[model samples]
Target: MFSPQGPSLRELCVQALSSVEHGYDLLAPKFDHTPFRTPQSMLDATTRALSGLGPFRTGLDVCCGTGAGMGVLGALCQDGTTGVDFSSGMLGQARSAYPNASFVRADARALPFDAGFDLAVTFGALGHFLPEERPALFNGIYRALRPGGLLAFPAGSRPPVTSIAHWATLGFDLALRVRNAVWRPPFVMYYRTNTMQEVSRDLTATGFTVRTVPLSPPGYNLVIARK
Candidate 1:
């Protein structure tokens, strides 16, 4: 489901075979044109949901790509926003796109900030982390936020086992496993890596009180956690 402006099949194949950071670097230029970018509708809904909860001062976007989530933070945070990503190419695009916002290249599991953000959010990035790695990621987010600060992200409900989306995701993850087994650097993006229950538990264990706000279009869940 890529547009004409998106990566070609050969380009995508090369990316899929590379490490996650390298793959994202290769895909960053066309990322917004692909289905990978968080949709504007979800963005708007998240903004609306955060409206009453915010008026936040400083915000951070974890794994922010081309800075789509920065738009939401710009509206919600008064002091400005920051977008952090491991991919240099993505951060480069983000810096160019949102010159007013700060962009940093850093690992989400070991964020550089210390209680520096009033709010934190992520979009379409969790699947890159293996389930076991989530605890560290959540802990880093919690440490980055001030006490009582919030962390938010949109998550999709699990697709039905019989649905095409389900089978497609399963096959994709399986293929990725096979590819990684033979590859030097592993690419880590799997649709089934994170689940609501597991994420909730991890967040709680990492000192966040989690809550879910049901989003529109029926399949989305907006998770808000307070540190």
Candidate 2:
């Protein structure tokens, strides 16, 4: 699923062996060319889904790798848009791409912001954080949003048990578990942990009124968490 401009198999293996942060740093330069990058169609669908709730002021994009979600913020927010990511390499690429937007280097688990944003969005980064880590990530996002602010993200519906996608995802997670069990600096990525019910519960616990709206494509949902 990688293009010629993307990292090679050897490069990917090297990355897989490293910590998540360093791996991403090594892959950052060619990240946009990879399938791992959030697709443009997904971003457009997210933008359309969030438009009705907007006329927002400042916007924040958590775990904003390469700033793809920043485009969503730029379109919806009137004041300014900011992207926060822990990887300096990713932040550099993001800053280069969207020179007008602000970029911050900080972990999503311990976001370094107050109630300064009216809206926030993240794309295709949920799997990076494990279930136990969700509390810190969501709590930090809650604190970063102003009263009556919103945090939106897209989540896919689970595939049917009979479908190949189901087995594929299950296999992927199993492989990741085995790797973590045997390797150092485990790469945390799982497909099944962030269910809609689980995420909604976490958001509610963090004081956000959680709700879901159908996105453009079927089997995808845009979760809106209001502060």
Candidate 3:
């Protein structure tokens, strides 16, 4: 659902046809007013979860759309925080919202940082990366963190086939597939392509020690990968 302040249906249709970066650029201004933005409930849970794992120094937010992870990281980390996203439009919103925090425009697959951060987090941005793109993405995140640094995010579990969510997500993924099959500049978001097992394997392959814990929200879990 979207608020009155959010983009109109026509605007969403236009965004759907654009490349992921451009689509997000178009959507960035009103992102927080839409359901697509990471909810405060999840951010709050992330903050609470990371609080125990940290007395962290520097923090990074991978694919930091509108800097949702900035607030989460700020609450947990003691010093510097940065939000990295490819979209200039998204970074603009983030800059306006958190002027004191750093924001960078860079692709997640080629993150431009050394092992400088003690902690990192991502929110609601994974679906844009294809299954094959994940290794590079994970590697970049892993490489950005210092030794013993943690990269964390709230991960969703697969819903059973009998459930409404399962069918809904399946339908959504199917629609995206069909759209990509017929369109140029394909939008990369999908509902069910990635799995926890696959993600864990990727993290491990990238030299992370991976683990998960049940988050406060009933259906979501947190995947923590330590460098």
Clashing pairs in 3: none
Clashing pairs in 1: none
- Superposed on all Cα atoms, the candidates' RMSDs to the truth, in angstroms, are 1.0, 0.9, 0.9
- Encode model 3's per-residue lDDT on 1-227: one tens digit a residue: 37799999999999999999999999999998998888899999988888888889999999998988899988988888999999999999999989989988999999999998999999987888888999999999888999999999999989998999999999999999999999998999987878888888888998999999888778799999999
lDDT against the true structure, per candidate, is 0.92, 0.92, 0.91
> Residue 81: error of model 2 in Å?
0.8
Instruction: Give the lDDT of residue 17 in candidate 3.
Output: 93
User: Model 1, range 1-227, lDDT digits (tens) per residue?
Assistant: 37889999899999888888999999999988998888999999999999999769999999999999999999999998999999999999999999989988999988898999999999999999999899889989998999989999999988999999999999999998998899879999999989899999999999899999988768998899998
Greater-lDDT candidate between 1 and 3: 1
Q: Residue by residue across 1-227, what tens digits does model 2's lDDT show? A: 37889899999989888888888899899999998888889899999988888779999999999889999999999999999998888999999999999999999999999999999999989999998899999999999999999999999999999999999999999988999999999988799889998889889999999998988679998999999
Off by over 4 Å in 1: none
Supply candidate 2's per-residue lDDT for 174: 96
